[model samples]
Target: MTTPDAPRHSRPISFAIFLAIAGAVGWWAAFNLTVSKIEVLENPSVDLACDFSVLVQCGTNLTAWQGAVFGFPNPLLGMGGFVAPIAVGVGLLAGARFARWFWIAFNVGIVGAFAFVIWLISQSLYSLGTLCPWCMVVWVATIPLFWVVTTRNLVEGVLGSSLVGFGAALRSWVVPITIVSYAVVVLLAQLQLNALARL
Candidate 1:
């Protein structure tokens, strides 16, 4: 049985740093999307600042039904959702640790975000036939953020059973796994969307 006096596995400072980095990127993406949305509302035909080319276009995605899945722009969700991580990161940096339930809730949010981004990536590749730069930025940050946070959760035993030795093993491989996943997505985009050629 775990003893109450036993030292808990506290999150490292680097975790907070990475979280802050991800939050900043997410915030930037959300802010720009909000701007693009406003522009669209102001002038239905207004050319978005992020509308770079036919391939890398936010206008197309913004106009898509998938853009406003909840009857509001998706970025609005980001604007609010990303605040939690930022706050949490700041708290961690200040030496505050959360309860098991809090970590579980945070992980759940990241999992949901990861799933949504995956769907967005698929739509951008197959259905939309377009990629938004801002959305892509969110995807980039979300991937690593989810990776690190999920791995941390497993290692810290926040989810049900404590992983024990498995957590350390997973942590060691997390970066490589995240990198491979990112490469696969980029490669797929290059093959299907000609992302490299567009660049």
Candidate 2:
């Protein structure tokens, strides 16, 4: 019989699949914006952000060397790398149970993508001196998606609940703490960046 204290199992694979889909959409938008900029640059046209000046200018940000950090269009990387995991995620969500190793591997990929998003934001703020609005959209979308995917993995025991401890330590403290901590950190970082901009 299932005990009252039995852990509630969620579909981590399904959450991962959803994140992958959202990431793919973000990547597509970014790619289209990049391509549009290229066309405009090659033959000059009404500026993309004519109404907005400075940091909000898409044309200014897109034309920067840092925008093509790979020495080619950066969106290509997003298109190729970001979409594959979503496809894998969809397979898993379809009830194709993955091995523990596969789940862990995908989790690592999500962490890597999270790190890369932070790096890109830093580049835009400090190095590029301009922001790609679509890229910011990707950043915002990625944060919650990562949190949900990671939380689902933890709750479902795919990452070993013991790694975060067990019992009340797992359910009550760790999960809530993680969620709140992430939200706080993201908020602080955004505020700090905005503060710096004013100085």
Candidate 3:
């Protein structure tokens, strides 16, 4: 058990920094892809399809109506959503002592972004039948970011002593169990999709 006075694990801040960097990179790549798509629309010679090979094609997923979820290039959303958190993480890493309430609010936003990423992944897998490589990067970065942020809050006693105890209990059981279960579900869903694609 961690002593009450012990410094919390530094992994959360570190992971947050790593994720922010990754997110920034992902956003940049997505933005470039979006620009490329616009160029393709302007010129017929450019094939927008992401399928450079049997396994990859941006146009296959991106040219579809779903790609413009809001009827515009979706990367703009990523650009705006990702940059602020990265800035916040960088500031925090630089020794900014954000108030507990600020951290809590940050966590809430992370949760929302995580959920949206998952939804987008599902849409790509099932509806688009192709994946944007940059989008996958965002999805991967989000998982660790969410986990680290939540774990940090728990370890740092940001949620209060009682909630910290509850979080510790949940971490020992619920967290791992939920992660494994979700992994299994995702794997099974992918297998099913692959099977259907073969048929």
Clashes of each: 0, 0, 7
Q: Estimate, for each residue in 24-125, the C-alpha lDDT of model 1 and write its tens digit.
A: 899889889989988998899997889989998899888899999899999998898888789889989988978899999999999999999999899888
lDDT (tens digit, per residue) of candidate 3 on 15-128: 557756866776776676677677668974676544454334566556677667788867677777777668776876765667889878878977887787777777777776
Per-residue C-alpha lDDT of model 2 across residues 135-166, encoded as one tens digit per residue? 76666656655666566567667888675444
Clashes of 2: 0
| TM-scores for every candidate against the unseen true structure | 0.91, 0.68, 0.72
RMSD per model, one decimal = 3.4, 5.8, 5.5
Off by over 4 Å in 1: 1-11
Ranking the candidates on TM-score from highest down gives 1, 3, 2
Give per-residue lDDT, candidate 2, residue 94.
Answer: 63
Considering every candidate listed, which one attains the maximal TM-score?
Answer: 1
